[model samples]
Target: MVSVALPQIGTRLSASPTGLQWVVDAYVLVYAALLVPGGTLGDRLGRKRTYLAGVLIFGAGALTCALASNLPVLLAGRALQGVGPALLVPGSLTIVRSLFHDERRRAHAIGLWSTASGLAMAVGPALGGVIVAQWGWRTVFWINVPLAAVLATTAWYAVPDVPGTGRQSGERDGDARRTGLLADLDIPGAVLITAGLAASTYATVVGQSAGWGSAVFFVSTSITVLAVGLFVRRERRHREPLVDLNLFLRRDFLAANLAGLAVFFAFVGAIVYFSIYFQHVRHQGPIAAGLSVAAIGAAFAVAAPISGRLTHRFGPLPPLTGGLLLAAAAFLSLTPIGAHSGMVLIIARFVALGAGVGLALTPMTQIAVQAVPDGRAGMASAVHNALRQQGQVFGVAVLGAIVYAHQDYLTGFRIALLTSGLVLLAAAITTLLLPTRRPRPASGRSRHQ
Candidate 1:
């Protein structure tokens, strides 16, 4: 939806190219940075409570954006919107894990969740376009307000109350006696990570226009290094760290997350440019551009549940690898796309790309969740989602830089597609390296714990 409205946003807000990038990155960076903390909050404070709070906050943010009078206000609202998803996304997955004990049932449930997400992706742009065309871009944000209200109301009755694990039986007396809601959270670690990611993203977005040698870039780079170094050190020493670094030690967990990162980096990065190409170069209106890109989401919605079934039958390896390869082929096919390329050809490529993403995403998510202990489901979901959002952040910054650096849109678009294709190929190879056997389901005791 936001992607479809970028041109209108730029024109209305008198925003520069860099400012446009910030409009996207502001939401993603905050979402990525806060995800671990949000998961921790869910694990300690209660997933349901955290999720509800997120909904309210997200709605407020949407309202703010809908009423924004300038670019800065809009960015502020976007950041606030990020806060809501940080809490809810991991909690949603954790709730699903709690509800579905059987592995097959859980996999199917996750596929349904992915399908819902794909449906949103499918509807958002086309709907946003229609809304923008009729009422203007402000209406895009307005729609979220009522939707959030309905979701909150429905979830209150429909969703289960999953208890927090903050006070397990094995905890020491002193630890158990801590009364503060956030007593167990690693605040310093969260702060450090948030600062690090922000600085890094700032450097990346600003470097294109300011040059690599600029003081702004150098200082931001230094800040990023220092902050991330501190964050790693803090997490290593802290008890109950925000992100359990030990999770990365598992081969499956590491590989799954890496695959997730690569997938989103390619998908999110390329889609934004596609939206731009349709509107700017192809001279299509918002409605046409939105409709043109709808093929990807439509295909994704159909393929996700099927992928879940495939994962159940064949294990994650075959379908995951196949999807990555398919996506790679789709991306590479677009390297020859020109301004005069037929709409039918472009739409076909997008459908292929969408199917590949839909197929890969469910299994990738299942693998990541399955690798961890049931007790750490929220944290695991957060880690996977955070990395995926980070992928989006970097995707926008890096890919946009690549596009902007070239003299013309066509050269840059081709180069970007080629880069994305190669990345997907590498991800496919990584998936193949995982063990062939399916991961065993969590034991009864572990599930109850």
Candidate 2:
């Protein structure tokens, strides 16, 4: 919601480009930073308690945003709102982990979860447009209040509390009563990785704005590299690290995560630029533009569940690789679109993009989580969301830079398509390296712990 609305608000508020990016970037940075902590807190305390608290906080943040009269206030509220999701997201997965314990059922449940989120991502802009057009921008913020209240209230009763069983009666939940906070939570590794990710995201976001050759961008890039290096070093040494460094070495896990990144990155530029294409280039109003994008989301709703069942039959690669091809094809198809292009032609491209991505994304995400152990599911899911969100930030920033620089919408769009296409191709090539077989757990542990 912040991603869609903040830029419009930035224009209305006459905000600086950096400030405008901050309006969205602040939320993302904070959300990614807090995710591991949120999961650790859920593990230590209880998911239900943490979730309800998150709802209340999120509701407050939404209310604050509605009442804001300036950009800083709104950005502050956005940060608070991010805190809620940081908490709620991990908590929701905890519930899913408990409810669907079996492999088959867990896969289906995860598929439903990923598909529903994509559907909402699909619907969000349309909903935002309608409210902003009819009532006011504040209407979008106000709507969250009632929805949050209902969700929080109902969840208090309906959501059951599940306690941790201290790690199978044979393992220690923590080597210490977790020592102090830093030791208990492995704060050093988390901090290093968080800083690394934030620096990388910042570098990516500001590359065009700050000039790719500028010292600021280069310094950020260096910091990102250094932080990642330190994070790897620390994770290798620490008995309990924020993320298990070994996970990235797994063929199935690494391949699926990379594919996930490419798919989101590929569609993201098209998604952002298409909204511009729908409105500015096509001369459609906000409502029409929003609804046009909704076509992809609606198709995602149809494609996800079917993909889940399909993955069970065909394995993850066929659909995963196939979806990227569709996205690439969809982007390349738009090369000739101009001011006078037919509406049906544009819709055809979006439909192909939505359906193909739906077929690909759900299974890839399933593979990402399903490839890890159960204990690490929350962290694994966090990594999955983090990587994709990082890609989205890069997509919007880098592609938008192309459009901004060329001053020709189609040229910029084509460049973005080429870049995304190459990313998809890279992911596809990596997928080919995976052994052609089903994953079998080592010693009967969950694949995605």
C-alpha lDDT score of every prediction, in listed order: 0.84, 0.74
lDDT per residue for candidate 1 within 1-449, as digits (tens), equals 87667778999999998788778778877887788778877877667777888898999999999999999999999999999999999988888887887777787788888888778878888898887778888888998999899989988889877766764555521133357656767888988887887787678667866877899999999999999899888898998887788878877888899999999899978887888899889998877877787788899899999998788778889889999999999999999998999988889999999999999999999988877766678889988998888787778777878888799988998999999999999999888657788656656764664
Residue runs of model 1 more than 4 Å from their true location after superposition: 10-20, 167-178, 438-449
Report clash pairs, candidate 1: none
**All models, RMSD in angstroms:** 3.8, 4.3
- Candidate with best TM-score: 1
What TM-score, computed on C-alpha atoms, does each candidate reach? 0.92, 0.88
97-126 per-residue lDDT for model 2 (tens digits) = 667665655656766876886688678988
C-alpha RMSD of candidate 2: 4.3
